[model samples]
Target chain A: MQRILNVFVKYRNSILYLFLLGFSLIFLKANSNFHQLKLEKISLFFSSSLYSFSNSINRYFRLEKENQRLLKENEVLKSIQIRSNTLFLYTEGCNNKTNFPFDVQRVNIIKNSFQSQYNYIIIDKGAASGIKREMGVISAKGIIGLVQAVTDNYASVISILNQDMKINVRFKNRTTFGSLIWKGKNPKKFSIEDVVSTSSIKKGDTIVTGGMSSYFPYGIPLGVVTNLENNIQNGYYKIDAELFENPAELYKAYVIENSDFKEINSLMQNIKQ
Target chain B: MNSQILKMMGSFVLLILAQVLLFNQINIFGSVNPMLYLLFLVMYPFDQNQTFYIFIGFLLGFFIDFISQTGGAHTIASLSVSYLRPIIMKYSYGLTSERPKSILTDPRKTNNFVFLLIFISVHHLIYFSIAYFSADAFLLIIKNSLLTMIFSLILILLISSLYRVK
Candidate 1:
């Protein structure tokens, strides 16, 4: 009994180290079989509350800048509203939530990241605000990201800067399209892979959401081509484009819940099976 | 002893708050955001129970990960560093490893600098690895780890110096 007690005291730190390390590794959502949803909910509860509280404090101090940006956005909106007044049929359907293709919810971006390739953003709106998983999020200037996780008062967005994110985009004023994937290193630039070199791409050709997937509405401005890497052997080359909306300057965003998302998803699933 | 414990607790909250609020928000050169929360474990006095320090490391990492929404990446990295810190100190400090507090006491010491480089680099490597979680991103992992380490080292050295014992 004395030897056992002595042994326990002697190696207690190592034992504790192994135990804690094991416990943490098991709970790691990246590669662990932990209770994923339960842990996510618990983490969401704490993290969302912390971020929102902190964001409110920050938002208080940035009221002036926020107001200026809001004023600019409001002007653009006024002009848009005025133009839409000429099209009563389109305006009427857009006002009615059911007839609208996507439901838009305005949320303050509490946190944003552009440094890491696996970057994510957190917004003040969430499940309670009608934001759901796989919903597209956008800033007024351009596309922002897609909502990945949601809680009651907050949601996490897979920012377009993330290397894992592949956005379906097509050249503006043309049908040729490809998927835009962040190539890391630069925040403002994305490399459009799967774009065939055969296409007569220009130096500054515009890019926008393809809208074929129905994730985003048709004709949403994304970026303009900056450079191209052409390789004859591969037949597929990289098209580098500079994003319209700088990732760091994102403040307010709209979570877009596609009305046809469910229908389209089911159709895809059925077709696959 | 009690007052010292309170001071440690106070800094624990302050450091993590500063990390998530201030440091996390600033993205330098568009890629490197300093992981300032690692400063707590770096300056943590090893005079305390080793097991207890490891637990505090876990808690600190968990809290940061919880807020930052990186899942358990921070938690795993922080705890691993917490466990390996003593051994690293043994190497960096060599003969004087018995007096680990000396490393914190004299922030300008050569041994302390070595310790910080090895320690923060290891932490950043583990963090970026878990973050990317892909074998294909081997080059990326090294790039991020090195870049973030430079920023983290600069910040940790400057800030932790403020608390350096006279």
Candidate 2:
């Protein structure tokens, strides 16, 4: 008993260090598995006081750029409005009149981060504003991210820049599709994988969000293909693209809620089962 | 000594607030966001209780991790670096009783600069490695750590020099 006590006393520092190290590693694992409930709420609380305040101060400095972006978005929206007004939705399968399932809510990003592997952005709107998980977010230029977690008054989005987020995207004007993922290498670039080699792809091809998952509506621009390499072993093309809306420059985004998301998700799950 | 603990606690909160609010926003070259929160551990007094320092180091990094939502990468990196600081200081100052009061206040000592660089690099490497957390991104970890370390080293050194007026 005396010898054991002396051993523990001598190595007490190392013992404590290891204990804390284990505690942190456990936290790391919990967070990685997306099981962070209490910590996430605490983060949301901090976001309101800490991030939002700084964001407001920073907003004044970027007024000129923000105005320009809004103007560009306005132009895009106006054109879309004109086209929609001129056209009509007529489908043979469904007799019900088209009520767009997607709801677009404009929200300000309190904090945008792309430095880490799994980056998340905090938006000002949350449960009070009808923001919920699995809702897709997009900027004026392209798809931004998906809402992964929500708290009252704030929602954390898993940005497209995150390594864990693989967005389903297809080449413009073509059915060829690939899953877009970030390599944690560069913020401006994304890699498209699992593209069959037979798909005719070229540099500068436009990549847009695929509506298969019902996350983003069909045809939201994502990026333009910049490079392509044939993965001979997998017989697929490893493609890279430069994003349209650079996340770092982004200040505002629209949180889109799909009214039929749960319905569609349940149907898909039922089919799988 | 009592006042010192109070100052440490005060600066602990202040530094983390500055980190999440101020430093985290600056994305130099689009990828290298300097982790200025590391200043606390780097400047911690060598005479303080080693065990306490190590534990607080974990909390210091854990707070950053919580704010930034990077899991425990910051916690692990910060904890390890604080644990290794004594050994690092041993080599950095060559067991001199007169460890420079401040890394930059005693600017003539080239060892101070080396110490700062090593500290930042090790922390950044461990940070990027854990944050990336995949053998697939080994090269990315190195590139990110190097770029971020350079910027972090510069930012901390620049901020510390403000106190070098004495």
Candidate 3:
């Protein structure tokens, strides 16, 4: 026993380091997939508070940019409202009527990270504000991401810049659709996969959401194609596109809710079963 | 003793704040993220208890990881660096009865530069390796670590020079 004590005393620092390193490694390994997701939730509680405090101070410095963005969004909303009102008037006289399928809720991004492979953005709205998992999130200029998880008062979004996130998009005015994915490097650029070599694609062509999924409506602007490469072996084009929204500077976003989402999902599930 | 503890506490708060608020937001050259918080471990007094430094390193790193959602990459890197600090100091400055008071306050600029280089490089190496943690990302890990280490070394040197420790 005494010999063991002497050994312990002799290498106490190494033992301590090994113990602490083991502990951290355990944490690193344990925080895989679900546990990592849960860890993010717990960490979000602390990060959100810290970010909120910092954002209060930081928000003032970006007031000019914020004001300009809000003004432009307001203008877009106003134009949409005017067009929809005219449509509503025209449809009122017709027997068959069309209605907008998605509802938008404005929320503030409490914390944002774009440097990591699995980037996440936490917003101030959650279940209380009708924000739910899988709801699409959009900034003023374009699509941001989709809600991954939700707490009582906060929702975490998987940013389009994340490697794991794949958004379905297509060239504006073209029928060919491709999957947009981040290459885990640039915050502003994403690559479009599965676009055929024969597709009518060009540099400076606009990319927009396909709206094949319930998350986003068709025609929401995503970005512009910046580069294109032909993969003769795969018969697919590797197209690079620049995002419209500067995610690092994004503060306000709109959470989109598809009213028919539940009905459509249940029907699809039934068909699969 | 009380003043020393107080100074360390102040440094802990200041470094963490600067890391989370300022450096975290700055992504120079797309991938080079300067982890200036490692400066705390770099500037830690060498004469302090080795075990205590390890614990402090763990606590400091864990706190940053919790905030940044990086799991325990920082904790592992910080603890390893802190544990190896004594050996690093011994090699850089040679054995002596009294350790150098501060890395920045080292009169020999070359020694200080060497110490900073090894310290930041090791930290970044461990940090980026764990962060990427994949066979395919080995090249990415090395690229990120080297790029970040260079920038971090420059920033740490600049900050330490401006900071005069009495």
Candidate 4:
């Protein structure tokens, strides 16, 4: 008995080590089967929660870029809506006619030049898609330009940012009309020339296209009044407006064809004769 | 004595956090994940009781297995290494069982390097073998163990050089 006790005391640490190691091996063998599935479930719960928490943080940083992408997608949908002729046909008492006076064809801008004074845009549609010269072009946000030239498969547009381009515009209330023209300076801004000084235009009035010409219909948005300067000597208001359409970022456009353009021109030629 | 115990407890928590949050997610060369949690076992004071070392190893391994879903592989491997660590130290550093502190603080870099290499290789061998327990996966086990051992050794040496215990 005494010898056994002495040996036990002398090698207690080694005994403990061996005992625990054997216990661990047995535990491993026992839990190697179905219990592993349970363990995996528990671990998945923890790791997935941690991953979602980190993912939420990552998503917050990308919200602005996501918003821009959504806006672009919305523009594409709006262009499709215009091409199907369902957008403007909702006006009261205008449901009987299936074909409206104007037809819109959606086209993608293949090439755009905004830095030069005489900016021009090339679109993917041409005479093959019924596109021709003197047709109005507009983006989802506002008016872009007019179709200046066309080939069998493509059309070049006289951009609204060009110095030679001008379009008739009116205030939102239809109180006064003016000519919208770019000043060869800022691409994002254009000046409404020939507005009489007696006009009641404010700093933030909404401007839209005037239907005086046969190209564009009434009430297509153009821009807003950013600055208004009254030239007392010239008796006109040098109205500066900020454009809604960004020329450099114009990806899609709608080509508006006035179906009665030839009839209206021929009637005016007969009157002149 | 109390401060040393507190420091050990702090190291225990830190090692587990680092293993779960960082090291487990990192896969170098598409296969090698440096097992940095083993540093706690390697850097534990050698002058402590052997039985206590084994108990700590089991606890640490069990906790890591619970978090990483490794199902007793870590526990078995860690316990084996902790139990046989004294013998390895004796063989690698020419030290006896009575003077264990000299092995850690010793100035000879080669002896320390050899000791760490042997210890980590043995741990990784047992770990990979148990984790991938299949006859067809023999080459896979060896390849994974050897690659992990290399990366773990580099990381352990770098961490030790930065923060010397003594």
Candidate 5:
């Protein structure tokens, strides 16, 4: 027993090092598996506080630029409203729920780190705001990202700039669809692989959500198609899309709240089971 | 000893905040990120216990990893640097009877700063390489490493120049 004690004492620091490293690695692995309790709520609370602090300071610092952007956006919105009103006359007692199913919650982008391989965006919204996992996010300009994890006061949206991102998008007025993904080369451009050969998608054609995502309503703006080609493998039409919103410049965003998301998720889970 | 510890802790906080808030956000290319945070581990006073030094490295790395969500990249990188710090110090400053804490060396010794630069560069290379293991972008890695090294050296030198150790 004394000999064992001596040996243990001799290598106490190394043992502690191994122990701590092992514990941390285990925690990381477990957290990665999606089994660990999501600390997103805690993240949300802290991030929201951070956002509030930063926003006030930034608002003061960048008032001129902010005003300029607001003016531009306001003018664009006014034009859009005018065009829409002229194009569509509302029929008596007609409700177009299909046009916008998701309640958009505007959240400020608190922190953004898209330069890294495993990049995530922190926004000021949480369980308190009814934001949850898998809900889509969008900016006034266009589709931005989807909520990956949610906490009570803050949530992380996986930016469209992420290389791992895959969203179901199709050309406007076309049945054919393809996956839009970032090429890790440019933030503005993303390559859409596996677009079918039959789809007559041309450059500058608008692409939108295929109505397949439960989070987003059908026909939400993605971006204009910039390039199209047939891949060597699956022979699907591959397209490069110039995303509407600049991920780098994203300051404000909207978290989509779908009323039917729970029902859809439950049904999907049951089907899988 | 107490004042030194407090100063070290204060410096570490400053380094971390500077790293995440400003430097991490500024991407010169797609690859270069300024790693001023490593200076905390790099410039620990020689008198500190080796185990404590390693622990500090772990904490700094772990904190960075948590915020950045890059797994154990920082922790691994920090450990490698801290582990090799003694050897690097021995090579540059010679074996001193003093503890491993940084001492006020003359600013005129560009050779010492160059040695320190090489040490930090090697540490960063090990770190970036491990962090980007599965990535096929070899040229990107090299570019990032070079930029990071340059940025780290400049930042560390600037801080060192400004810092007055009483």
Candidate 6:
């Protein structure tokens, strides 16, 4: 016992450093899987209170401009909704047009970024507002991204501009589909790969979500074709698209909650078997 | 010791409040976020109890991390900085026998300030890199870290200069 005490006393600093470092590493590892409930809840409350104050300040500052923009966008949205409803009526029995199976909650973009290759946006909606991880986010102009993290009344969105983000995008007219990637140099541009050489690709074509993702609905606008190239080795087409919505200026967005998301996810999980 | 503890707590709250309320919202260039909360860790009294300082640093970082919801990246980063801070102060600032706080106030404090700034920048860089760890997007991590460090250094320098540390 005396020898052990002496050894511990001699190496106390090293022992303490190792122990602290080990705890930190373990904390990080555990955090990747599950968050502490009390901490998360407290954080959510704190973030929400701050968000509310900031949001109010923003509204006070930009009331007139935001009102005008919203009015214009609302007019456009009403017209589009009418047109879509008419189209749905005509294709009532066709079964090809499945109305989006999600609930979309309107939200304000409190903070946003697009210039960076790994940009993220903060919206004024969160778990308290029926939002959760993996929900689709979009605006009147186009698809924005998916929910990355959620507090009580606020959430962080991983913008499609992020280099880590890849989504199934397809040309609306030519039916050419590919995986879209942000090349990190330009906020307005993204590269789409995996289109076969046989695809009838062209510039000035509109791109939209391919519905391959369970989060976003089919036919949500993505971008327009800007450039196309052929991979000599693989003989596949790589298309560059200019996104319609400027992610940096996203003021109002929609958080889509698919009612059947759980059911679909469970089914897909089983399909892996 | 009582005054030092009070100052530590005061800095902790001030940093966290600034981080959550102001700096977190100020992404000036879409690529830069000045993590001013790191200032607390950077400015902790060099001669403060090592274990106590480390605990304060971890708590400060944990509070920020909890709000940002990026796991424990900030906590780990701040802990590392606090652990290394004493060594840095000793090497760069030279711990004088004079009650350690006075050594920090000398006008020839540029070296110490630079050391502190570098340490703070490294903390922010590591925190951001770990928060957005992606093997495929290593370039993004590098780009963001550099941008954040640039902003963090500028902000920390400005604050250190303005702080009337008597």
Point out where model 3 deviates above 4 Å.
A34-273, B95-98
Candidate 3: residue A40 lDDT (0-100): 68
**lDDT (10s digit) by residue, model 1, range A167-261:** 89888777788998888878888889888889888889998777666677666778899998888888986788998878767887776668778
Model 6 reaches what TM-score against the true structure?
0.43
Clashing residue pairs found in predicted model 3 = none
| Global Cα lDDT for candidate 2 | 0.81
Model 2 agreement with the true structure over A1-273: per-residue lDDT tens digits: 999999998887789889998899788878775425534655688988898899989998999899878866765573353224223322322223244456677788999987788888999999999999999888877878999899999999999888888888889878898999987878888889889999899999999777667787767777899998988888999898999879867878887677888889999999999
- Number of the predicted model whose DockQ against the real structure is largest: 3
Q: What DockQ was computed for model 4? A: 0.23
What level of docking quality does candidate 5 show? incorrect
Q: Write the per-residue lDDT of candidate 3 for residues B33-66, one digit (tens) a residue.
A: 7999988898887767888888999999988887
True contacts kept of 1: 0.59
Query: For candidate 6 chain B, which ten residues in a row score worst on lDDT?
Result: B97-106
Worst ten in a row by lDDT for model 2 chain A: A85-94
State which docking tier applies to candidate 3. Answer: acceptable
Q: Fraction of native Cα contacts kept in each candidate?
A: 0.59, 0.61, 0.71, 0.51, 0.07, 0.27
Q: Is candidate 1 or candidate 4 better by lDDT?
A: 4
Best by lDDT: 3
Residue B1 of candidate 2: its Cα lDDT?
Answer: 77
Off by over 4 Å in 4: A1-76, A79-90, A93-102, A114-117, A248-251, A260-273, B1-166
Give per-residue CA lDDT, model 5, range B54-143, as digits (tens): 788778877877777766667767766775676777777656533333634544365458556767887788777655553465776677
RMSD of each candidate relative to the true structure: 27.1, 27.5, 26.1, 17.7, 26.7, 27.2
Per-residue lDDT of model 5, residues A99-179, tens digit only: 333565667899987787556899998889888888888777667788989889999988887888878876776777778
> In candidate 2, which residue pairs clash?
none
lDDT of 1 by residue, B1-166 (tens): 8998798799899988888888888988887889988888987776777889889999999888777666688888998899898888877878643565645675448988999899999999999887777677899999999999999999888887776633
Candidate 5, residue A156: the lDDT equals 90
What's the ranking of the predictions by TM-score, best on top?
4, 3, 2, 1, 6, 5
Writing each residue's lDDT as its tens digit, candidate 2 over B1-166 gives 7997897788899999999888888888887789988898887776777898899899999998898887888999999898888888778777856766656455555788888888888899989877877677899999999999888988888877764553
Lowest-sum lDDT 10-residue window in model 4 chain A:
A89-98
Better of 2 and 6 by lDDT: 2
Write the number of the candidate with greater TM-score, choosing between 2 and 5: 2
lDDT of 2 at A9: 84
